[model samples]
Target chain A: MSDTLRPTDSQSPQPVQPLLARIKRRSFFMYAGATAGATALALAGCSKDETTPSSAATNVSFGTGDASVLNYAYALEQLEAAFYAKVAALTTSPLLAAEVPYFAKLATHEAIHRDFLRTAINRDFGGTIIPDLTPKFDSIDFTKRVKAATDTKLGILDAAKAFEDLGVAAYNGAAKLFKGSVYLGIAGQIVSVEARHAAYVRDLITPGSFATNEGTDVLGFDRQLTPTAVFAIAQTFVEQKLDASTIGQ
Target chain B: MNFFNIIDLLAEADPDVLDRFSSRRAVFNSLGTVAQRAALATSPLFLGALFQKAYAGTASLPTDILNYALTLELLEADFYRQFLAAGQIPAGAAFDAITVIKTHEDAHVAYLHDAVIKAGGTPVTGSSTAGIRFNPSLLPATYADQLKYAQVLEDTGVRAYKGRAAELIGTDLLTPVLQIHSIEARHAAHIRTMRGQQPWVSIGDDLAADANYKAAYTSGVASSTRTTVALGGTTYGIPAFNPAQPSPQESNLQQGAAGTKLALLITTGIGSTTYLPDDAAAAFDEPLQAAEVLDSSRAGGLLA
Candidate 1:
């Protein structure tokens, strides 16, 4: 649980020391640069009260230890469940008649996943579970699929595919971070289901593309992304600012 | 009270600290009356001796675990070899998918063979490796049948890796095993897609005809190895090897060491109102035991 993300005075070399100790020189610079950018963004967004550092407002710290890892997963599950719930709610949409019910099933699975992680965290690390997050889906244009990649909003299928793939990578990367065998076992149970979901969604986007290099690597391994990299992409779809500085600490 | 409280606190702080003590529960369950009383009076020396005795017969070496994986990889590779060599596979996307999967399985065999050798263990080979040879008799005749059989093998391979993962924890072997395990899952999903089925395990997955193929979903060894018991009047099937950790079945409502039932929606408290019973169980895939995996491969006629 290093307090590495705390806003520090540039004049004093105090806070940077622990950052230097914990991370490599290259990673240290990257984190410091991101924090500096966060500071600027926060300053621009806040009102006339220039005295307060908006670091707390802009960033959602994942905290530290195994509990932090669980909270990180819980946060992702919340986003996925929220996204599929929205898709399932669409009454008249471009999605095929046959495919609509499957979305409802996917929604249920993600909701069950969200609730499962919350209960696991509450039982294993009571009072440490992160609060239920508020979702932001303004960017998703659920009505139609846009051909251009640069469009601000994504079609439902496009969004579902991205979320499923990201979730699989998140679980794959986070699997080794769990210290307890019980938590590790639970992670293993959920990750394969996510992979299955990813494959199914990918095929819906393009038949026979399932498990290809688009989703899996050239070596035929599924992608594994660290929390820092995952949240960088994930935070855009989410309104709640997340800080993984202490995750798996 | 003080001693028990201390144990509880230590267990909470770092559960591995109490691993030796927890392991004692399994040993005690099987110990005779005289031996059980003797174990209770444990000095440090006696406990250490008891611990060694407990693990000596049961503990699987890292080498053994790696070789076990290597054996499965060989089985899969050989199956694909027969598949590609069959010469009747129709040309198209489905055929290409099988080819890609076959290439990956070959690479898996290569990687595991080298891994086992590097870990100071002899990699079991097809030559003179008496029990682990491939049997091509069960290779399906038609393209559709081949795809069905492929799905079964890939699903079994995924579950087999998951079954042994707990044994590899805290070792250098875990990362590679998991890497391959995820790939196997991806392979299983795509194969299922080619067969026009849902990627996730459907309730009562009726893809294969053999009753034993259900072992891919739930696996247990012969009944003689375990005594039958009932939980809330429902009789539970017992496993022959490692009775303490029975293989998980797809129909299992419970998950993790806490045994939380996802299907029950205990956390949500809405019960099956929001969540269907089948989808709740379908959401999580279960692990298979190594003994059960062996049984599956044998049944598929892939093991000589």
Candidate 2:
């Protein structure tokens, strides 16, 4: 009966192979393992530096939140305070009889801002952020008020203008990052004062220059700067590394 | 099988499904990638569109914009008034200086209002907006609060002029705005000094934390970088203007270097030499445009 069944070609069916099925399953497993391993590695890499501060603190890195923003402002304030204090301590000129009082007042103001920011950071974030600063004042002759007839004893005025104008733009650009209304309100008040300082300094250097490009932006608008851009400049004076990846995130 | 034939067979077997699939696929694919990319590629046009919406729509020149500007000045005026009233300003030589600064802000409000009126606008009357009103909630009811208020007002004033200076360019009322703008800067310096802050803290510091102050100061220093001395020459590394753009009167003045030289001269000390050169005597500094002035004034000028 077996021989008869094998001999009947029309009634016999073709044998199906199981080898291909085994190969397909093995391939699928291999791909799955690779994908799993890749995903695991990715997660591990992402979590490695989650909270630890970077080792190179002098590299001028920033954290990715409001703290970075404050650090930026603090850096600028430090630079300004330092410059004005230098000017106050060493008057380039006799400092016009009327200008002495003005400079002295400005000196006190800068000190307050510098200390206030330092205190705020310490109190609110518990983060110590006073960085060592080295200003590049080789371009400026602090000792001489004027080297030429066209040049005036307006170095302090010019320096003041640059700082005030920069301050105004920095604050305006940062206004959006503030989440709390109270902080926003405080920022608003501070920016106005900075603008006023910009105008005053510009006018001092050039009468009728205030509010103009000659004084401010001739186009009649305030300037704006992104955190990244502002930080780049601030990095110059700062010796310590600030990891600002957390700013405005 | 040929690719086309396979496609044809699939279409024939389920024409309805293929049609629906293709139509849906087209929509999804279009939505998924090309739309945003296309929009970004046309960014300049998009920016122009955005500018039009911001500056040309019915909502353009909104009252909020003006109110914001006026509110900044008002806040500053109030801070100085409060300081003067509370006797926070020390009596004696320093008091006179503070008083002069306080008066300057009052004058700023008056002149700012005048400019607003000239532009057919109304001055802000009260502080109702959350941003306009100080959050008395944050203060600890100490003199610190007062100092904080003073700092806020002074900073705001500095930014306000910076924010609005562009809008005021080429306008008839720009002169007054400029006057106020300078006076506000002086006030800011005075206040910063009062608050023990640096008068020029914001210059060249990009990472500055305060948004309002940064925005007003660092707008276009790199791109349209032009610096001219009063003595008719370029200051720093900035280039001088071409003669082609000079006005007719400027052309006549250009015939003689003396006029241009006089106009460009910068005086070092406060003396008779401080005067602009004879050729520049008739040359009034260009004023800001009304719209620009308004827009800047509103964009949190001193207050931002």
Candidate 3:
């Protein structure tokens, strides 16, 4: 693209607002700047999420190459989808009535991620998507919103925080592994939403506690965990014996 | 290697080189005997990139990107600095949160300042630099008004990072850049929540709804084609705006590439009447072109 075509934002052509009041920094939709994209909303689109994940690959290995990086994401999204689906399903739970809708919204997002990755992997990589393993919820008490210090079972919020934080870190860490820019771009699309989710959950657990976690440091950098480290913690919630050692190699 | 001799050599080469190295504490050992430059000299994104730039006098994609990032960090750090000095922050969580966000912005400025130099480029300065300013005269006087700017800055920070992130793919720098990227998102979420909105960018979120703030959500580009970035002799392109999917507008619902966007509330529902345009819009944040970032009222536009 030539300089004539590019928006000369840095040139300061517009009138100055008091203290740059006109400057709007929100960048949620950076690529889709057209009404054409808006019109497509009415059209029926991508596949709905599979309600039941397959149990085919018990010892799943997200194989090498760019495919491995994607599979790693697929695994995490699957786990989150399952976790939130259960949270949303609670006929009775510890969550406040007002807070319930948030979890419901979360369920849909996770399911979308799960299905999107599943389809993309299957389409682009041709059957490279790993089988979705069953989640292990023995340690989580579905009835509780948060666990007390003495309690053994984890609360709903506890798991949500863990999953969202892990998801952000996993994406952040996994970006370098992608050889191609397209998948890396797609991963960037998803990870910010995960960070938003993580922030929201953190605030829920402790008000005003957003962005103050140990995963982030004084330098304001969030955590970036390699696949092996991510999988070690992720293993606790799933029954599958998955190996992520080769991911991003 | 003798530490003093190395420092002497470095100081001889450039008197301010030590100041440019931000991690002096980390560079030195308990005995202060280690060859400090050796640790950084081996890191390509650091000294190696700089050496090339110092001699070649040419900027790579990463250097340009870092300078772009540094410009904003300086702008943001200054915004909060003025806001905090004003002393109007509410006494509870708001105060704490703003303080933390300000700290992060400052850290970002410091971190990027050093990174830019280490990458073999001149670090962009705050206020005095072109396209970046912290105009105290322009700052909103009231806390409520300042929060609006804060929200805009934080969210813009997230988008700016995302827009340029693809260039860093496959580099060691992607991780740290991503680390910063997620924090920006976290800040955006918090600022939104503090503003009485959802943590995520919902369709027609108040900022987007406002005519003045609309650019915050849209790509500010007339075309759907994204600008590519040159990195390490490779150029990377973003998938074009799939008319089959959502556009860069915050309200666009369908998400994904040309043939594969999933229509959430429009086509499939999660059995909830509460399924909203907001959630669908919030699910996927777009990775816009650096040029698409608008001037005067949007992310990249915030400069100057």
Candidate 4:
């Protein structure tokens, strides 16, 4: 995919190299220790981000000013696009048959967001765009719709909700950082659509819980987390550590 | 008439009345000395809601933008209140959910009101419902009509905030406006879900198919004459957009600049999904001019 599953960013072979290595390492581990028939379980169990010690060294700086903000959004969209792609590609998806269409829609929407940001950033800032991010969805179980509280890995819906809600807050807090009105306007356009996605996913999880606490704050205001706070949560799901310092400054 | 209904009445009276400085611009421009005297001594009587709404508390404070925002919030909040009272919504989940939305809207009204007053400007007061707008009798007297209207209002809320958000970018109010904007989208999505429609805006998501709700999908943008906006002691202007095309409607697949529209539509082969023009349209929600928010078929048509 242009947006995910591979690196098609401004940086060519560099971004692709690490991602390929990560998957290859997991493949070797599964074949050497586990049997051939247990491939799915082996990949899920042994492919956690912790196994990749090189991840911490792969920290990405999103650059300064509007470049940083655009990169911040691009990084998130990358993670989301990758996650939904895996979900949609699931051979043994635990998600309901009726709910499959929603994931498909989410997959395309996220890819569009990711690719659009890439196109915009590369067009506007040229060489300053960040390298393609490697999404670490090892902690998500595509075979489960919702996981137990004690489970380390999340189900499909849990991860979707988290990504959508995180996306909404991220845009709200970062949009004002943009100096240009057109960019800010575009950010507004995308964030509301993200909110819509979040609400629909929330309803799927709980009948009438759309736009609840996870989406809105106490005063009925929607959640607006700063980039620093957002990056903290995002760093857990991605192989790269993103530093949002000086964004929109 | 309830206290807030008067705001809707005026919104219905002038479809181009935005978050509106056009009619009030020449009037406000002449009030260079309003800071030195009473608004009543200088302004005419016809400028009622907007006059006080824009120049409510004091003349020295710059709060026309915030006042415009407050005007919309008050209108939506009152509409929800009246709709809840009409008993058209189903009980259990549907009623509970709409009530939750109404609560958030009311909270927005309170917060925006205080924000205006805190900026050293008088907050616009709500008026009686006697001469209120938002005609409730035009529908088929059904719950589906109620939900559809709510969907239109919520989507409009999202677009309205997006339209004026750039004006408040330099100020501290941008995030709050954005935060509220998303919440409105959430409300829109939930209502659309109840109606069994796609959660996000799509090309087929036509509110105008019924003909009566034509204004909901109608397009408008800030006029070239009103391009510059003043905020926080600095004047900010909109970036260059095609005057030939202006603001695109909900069904528009083109985003950002024309040069980048194709790039934004990149499908990239994710799970055999080739995104069409409609997906591009649904991915982004365009802004509606604050000057052209209400129209005969949109929110204005509901005005009594």
Q: How close is each model in CA RMSD to the real structure?
A: 8.9, 26.8, 21.3, 14.3
Q: How do these models rank on TM-score, best leading?
A: 1, 4, 3, 2
Q: Which stretches of candidate 1 lie over 4 Å from their true place?
A: A1-58, A146-152, A214-218, B1-20, B23-44, B50-58, B127-133, B208-212, B223-240, B243-245, B259-274, B296-301
Question: Which candidate number maximizes lDDT?
Answer: 4
Give Cα-based local distance difference scores for all models. Answer: 0.69, 0.45, 0.70, 0.71
Comparison by lDDT, 3 against 4, better one = 4
What fraction of the true interface contacts does model 3 reproduce? 0.69
Summarize candidate 1's per-residue lDDT along B154-197 as a digit string, tens digits: 88887778777767766767766776787788788888877777
Give per-model TM-scores.
0.78, 0.39, 0.72, 0.74
Candidate 4 per-residue C-alpha lDDT over A1-249 given as tens digits, one digit per residue, 9 for 90 to 100: 233423333233244333323344556555535554333332332324345434433557677777788888988999999999999898888989988988898998888888788878877788877778888788887778998888889889999999999999999999877865667888898999999999999999898888787423665678888899998888779876576776766
Model 2 misplaced regions, further than 4 Å = A1-57, A91-94, A128-130, A146-154, A214-218, A231-246, B1-304
Q: Give a tens-digit lDDT track for model 1, residues A1-249.
A: 234543354423233334344444466456657674533533333435334432224345577878898999999999999999988887786788778877887998898888877876777688787767768787789886432576777888888888988888888777777666667777777888888888788778887676777634646567888899899989877755666777877
Best of the two (2, 4) by lDDT: 4
- For the predicted complex of model 1, DockQ is 0.40
RMSD after Cα superposition, model 3 = 21.3
Chain A alone, TM-score for each of the models?
A: 0.76, 0.66, 0.76, 0.77
Model 4 misplacement above 4 A: A1-56, A214-216, B1-62, B127-133, B138-140, B206-208, B221-245, B258-274
For each candidate, how many residue pairs have backbone atoms clashing (under 3 Å)? 1, 132, 13, 13
TM-score of the second chain in candidate 1: 0.75
